[model samples]
Target: MQALKEAQKTVVSNAPSAIFPANLDVEYVISFRYANGGQPAQTGDSSTPEEQLEKLLHTLDLAGLRTVVRDGGDGTLLIFTRIRSEKKLLGEIYRSRVRDWLHGIRPAAPEKETQQSIEKEPLTDGERLRLVYSLITLPNSEGGAGITPKQGEWNLVQSIFALHDHDFNKKWLKDWSTKWLIGPEDLKVIRDRFGEKIAFYFAFIQWYFIALTVPAAIGLFAYLFLPAYSSFFAICNCLWSVLFVEYWKRQEIDLAVQWGVRHCSTVQRKRAEFQFDAEATDPVTGEKIRYFPAYRRLMRQLIQVPFALVAATCLAAIIAGVFSIEIFLVEVYNGPLKMILKFLPTVLLSVFIPIVSTILTNFATRLTEFENYENQDSYEAALTQKIFILNFITGYFPLFLTAFVYVPFGEILVPYLDVLNVTVQHFGHDEKYTTSDTGFQINPSRLKAQMIYFVVTAQVVGFVLETILPQVKRTVFKKAKEFDSRRKGIDTQTVLDPPEEKKFLERVRHESELEVYDVTVDLREMCMQVSIFKRWEV
Candidate 1:
């Protein structure tokens, strides 16, 4: 905002003849630009923050950046372009919109003499129970799970939502609640069902298995040192890793069933983002989820292959370039401080690795952003995978080169650089392939590269990732902000009566301050958190 304000003077004096500027701060401008960079094909797919943001931006108003509308000669007219007229006014504005949305409040119709009529009907016990059930599901589903199952499927549904005493979280409004690993009644139920011995043992084993690795590490070494090549040590490590994986997998299923979350995935995958059609409440959940997956979600998924490919290629290139430079410096360059210079190659590679990794990461991030998946978990997971790829490349590639290329093949391959001359005796001049004078050597020095890359480079990477990068980003952002465009506008148009308009305006405000789109994006996010299935087997 400060920069935008400051830049306005420049816009007028330096570039005002061609510019007009109005509104919002720098980060919002950058966010707006990237968010609204281009129109998605009416659909977007990605499982990353950036992509979700892009989709949301497009779904709403993408062009809300304040602009200096250059409308005339030396215009410099600070004509504000409303990228999103309602977005900026958050807090009360957002709440008001959601309230209106909930109430089915909209632009008022022609005012007529208002009349109220009340009808009295006696309520039966069955009706009362139904109403009670509906109330329980309020703020979400109501009587969806109340009825006895006419079909076998409802039995499973009954079991899923079977009333178990949840360890109440003050945060939970209804069913979408965060829960502990095990609840008290849940423990009792598991004991009754699975038997106390089996259940207790299973629970205890899970607790200790996840906990004892440190002691286990010490124990492993104690046994290993007693008799190195220790089959016992090997067995323990292998057994622990395998057991952890297998146990966790089964435990997840058990927990899912016990917690009644196993059936959570049956909900639709799409957001029903803009509900132009679905006004009716869901028959199953009884919540007013919008339904706009008019197009198949799978069709939106073809973009993943391309995204993966782009990420892989970019990572590969960075790795290749970094490895080449490291190899050349460590093996070929016999420059000053040769002993210390050996470290120079590593130092240089270490420095370049992050830069290269960052570039690939940025590319992958952009690609993911382009893909726009709805669920934050899926979106973040996809982005995390991309980061992992870049990490693998820069960190692992140098080691790969050392092991396969430099250590194993350097002796023979380096000899090819030897001087070879072809003398043109009759013609007088001769052409020669002059190899460098240094003898090709493969020594423990090759391993040094690996050690440096793994130990030193890993620490460096961790520090930068955990600490430095965030600080740097903050500092840079603080120093500079983008001008031109902001989140909203106010039309005082009184589209709704003052009361209704307040509610409507609230809906359009900043999301932080706005109403939550009560419409869940469905079970897509939850499914993503669970295991990714290759295929479903009946």
Candidate 2:
């Protein structure tokens, strides 16, 4: 909602002593409001917000911020500053610059023409922004100035700058879809606006999408043209999975270097919930650091093995029960309304699996906390691994059972279900349906059917759960709360002490909701594509 101003810089004509590619140019604002307290106030300087803004700018100058200021009205101010190194120029000389030097070793006029040509060509600019937002978020020695906008000097800071431009990001994504490719520059744009964490996810997935296409195309061909349930296809798919996983590890490192986040984990702050046992000085940095027993944490992590087995067993039992009922209804049941009843098990599984998975996911979070990871990265990784495992069992295991177990062995096993015919009778059929009559066979193509539903239908369901359901729940809750308040004769509408705060809040309110829902879409697409390949092989 904030009207975004493009962060721009003028071209530098002069050279500098050192190349600092890591340095970033960032633009941010700081806003503050007067403190309101019930108790008698202590004697202090009663400076106005405008006067505070002037003082802040002076302090920024002292802290080496070459800032440009503008009035933001009320208790807010807009401050723009370029985070540059002490040197005038930033970044290493590209190889192109060296090539230009080689050209200069020849004739002067030719060298000048080569230089002109190089200069004329448009090039990617801006040093990798590093953690520009982070640098501004912390205290100076700790890497940031603690001059963040949402709060700083007073208790009434209204809003931080907008995280993104809605229209621009929409257009950008539209163009990306039309082009079917995301370049490094596109990822850089995301990093500049949102932050590296989200951008890293995008980058990893973009590479994944591109890599997946080769195998996907091959599998589609095999599914259509190769023999059904081909062992060759299975082997190829397995090989592809292994190759893809290994390749992604190298790709992660490449992206880390490209984003200047190779050392990012080292600077990451301690988790807010992290409890410390002791403190010691870092031998190299001489900084005091919190200490926790790694062995104790590892011992706690050992609990996950049994917990995971229990979760997987519960999910597998659910899946197996669904599969047996489905196979029975389809292959053995001669009961009333057979077609309708055949789908009931699937429908039931669809409803219950997500519910069960949610409960297990909540449990996984507590288990992850028990592991007591030192950094956010490790914590999230472990948690994601747990979710992936839970989903693998809950989502894929049922289909696997149907494809590998039920279909292949239904002839040997399903005949026993004929005993139910004594209790339940079919309306249309006169003859008792037996294993011999239908050959006790379930179609291997049922696997393909399941894959189709998983790929197409599962996506719709996930989108609803991830995007629509949350919005609907929030809206309904808000309305119910408002209605309840009205019944109590209490106002629920937000009221700001200062009028200026209203505009800032309005701008930021929309900005705060600009999360990339496409992330879910992308992840689900990749997952289903992987599932399709694996299922097709079976």
TM values, all candidates: 0.40, 0.64
Off by over 4 Å in 1: 1-237, 250-269, 272-310, 339-395, 414-438, 444-457, 476-538
What C-alpha lDDT does candidate 2 achieve relative to the native structure? 0.58
The numbered model that scores best in lDDT is 2
C-alpha lDDT of all candidate models, in order: 0.38, 0.58
- Put down candidate 1 lDDT per residue, 198-298, tens digits, no spaces: 34444644454354564356455755575644556555655554565577668766765653334433322331111233466779987675433535445
TM-score of 2: 0.64
Model 2 segments more than 4 A misplaced: 1-163, 211-213, 216-225, 231-253, 263-268, 282-285, 416-439, 496-538
> What tens digits encode model 2's per-residue C-alpha lDDT throughout 1-538?
1112122233233322011211123244444343222122221347555565566666565444456543343223345454443222222123323333444421212223333433553222222222333344445444344553433352244433423344665777787887777888888877655556667778777777787787678778887998876777778878888888788888787877775455445444444345568889999989978868988888988998998998998888888878777877886776557769888986888788888988998899889987877666677778878877886786678677876777778778877777666556433345644223555666767877777778777778777877798788767865786687678666444444256345544554433333434353355446755765555544
Global local distance difference test of model 1: 0.38
Candidate 2, residue 229: the lDDT equals 65
